[model samples]
Target: MRATSQDTAGGVRRTRNAAQTREALLQVASRRFARDGYASTTVREIADEAGVNVALISRYFASKEGLFEACLAAAVTDLRRDAGDTSLEAIAPSIARRMVGATSDGGRLPDTLLLLLRSSGDEHVDNVRREFLQSLSERMAAASPAGPETLLRAQILLATTLGMALLRTSMSIQPLAAATEQDLLGPVSDLVDALLAEKR
Candidate 1:
């Protein structure tokens, strides 16, 4: 049988539909997970929000856990890919700002951080969080020069970022939590560069 234009068009449409459905599911899942926590958000709710059948979600992602993983991946697409065309040193203040920006609304924490915190309740989510952070660590480390110290810096920076998020978002500590962007950025930049300094 010969290929038909309608068949080709239908194939392209199906691919596009699949992408749209996946994106919709991801968007809804991120919001629901962030607002309600991982264990609380149901697949049916996600499907309802995405205006797709629950089966399609499983078709797109093997399980609810898999869909959650995709949500996590999509949440930090910016950070996952690249920060900016600058030295890791140059991005410290921005990272610091991001830490504060976690609770961008002064109420709800970010979806990414929420996913991480909520991941601990279940074994599967634990693996997701662990793998996600491991890959994240590798990506950040790759951006900097290769060495023991740089690798150390990468790990330390990851801890620092998460610690700041916890302190500022989870714990809501005083002064640091209430500080102005100007106040936090300067200190964060200095702290970041201090690690970049030649080992004494």
Candidate 2:
């Protein structure tokens, strides 16, 4: 049978409400997971902050684990879109700037990285972290597909980028943190260039 007008209206309302709740939960959960970590943050806390029912956590995200994963996925998607290609030049100057709070939502980069780092002890988080690393490695490898040592090169390149992110934000290293975006971009771009340039 075709749906009635009331049925269609109700369905639309439900869809809109679900979308709003999911967005609210993500906005709160992202900050909480980043600040308090996965194990420490409760579903109730996320729900309360989002001004929704605690049950919404289960209804919308299934569980705290699911919500955590969703947060990671959303953040990664945003970064990939914002950063453009994973190219060394594309990453450091453009992406790196966004990571270091050079823009409004740019701070999410460090937040997500730190969240993953802090949550690494958990088995699920470990798997997710591995997947995240592997994806980046693949992209990096593809960028220099001619090399026999693509995997190693990718690992080194990522390590450099991750270290710079930590020092500039998480570790709160002043020289790097205080440096102007242009100055920081130069060194990072050069480092990435050298890494990409080497075959051995």
Candidate 3:
């Protein structure tokens, strides 16, 4: 059956409206999460700020934790894309540049990441950290040699990245933050190379 022009127009309008609503929800959630922190921000509050129903928030994000995880996952993935593959020697520096770029993008990360860092003593934070480390291990294991050397490299790589992330995003120490991208990555890359040189 062929649809009339009016019917097609209505369908398009509905899709456009839904997209706008989703974008609005994400923008509001990002701002609220950044400003109030994940633990402090409630779904109801976010929905209220977005002028959407509480039910709509659940429908979109399932839960507050889910929303925060989604946002972090998104931020991490974007950084990964920017980092690319700069070889094990150069990866650290590339990653440092990418981290600085991502953080300084005037986005939601600075505030939201600080919130996560402050909440590091929380059980959920530990669980999330474990999950993140395990995820990184799985990726490295899939790509690298299955030996102590590769495992050590994976551990060092992850630790370096996590430390940089915490320092840049959470600690916000002026000297650490002021360090040039290469200045930070040089030591990290050396550490990674040393780890990679280790044998089982």
Tens digit of lDDT per residue, candidate 1, span 56-141?
A: 77878988888877766565554454344346665676675555454322223334565565562556657766776776666567
Instruction: Estimate, for each residue in 1-200, the C-alpha lDDT of model 2 and write its tens digit.
Output: 22222223234422236677788898788877776677788898888888766877897788887888888777666655665576644656764576556324434566755555556255775687778777876787776634677777777877776676667665678887677667777787776666665544
Clashes of 3: 0
Clash numbers, per candidate: 0, 0, 0
Query: What's the TM-score of every candidate structure?
Result: 0.60, 0.72, 0.58
Q: Name model 3 segments beyond 4 Å from true.
A: 1-17, 27-37, 44-56, 72-83, 103-132, 138-147, 197-200
Which lDDT values do the candidates have, in the order given? 0.64, 0.68, 0.56
Candidate 3: residue pairs that collide:
none
- Candidate No. with top lDDT: 2
**Candidate 1: stretches off by over 4 Å:** 1-18, 34-36, 48-56, 75-77, 100-109, 113-132, 135-150, 167-181
Query: Which of 2 and 3 is ahead in lDDT?
Result: 2
TM-score-based ranking? 2, 1, 3
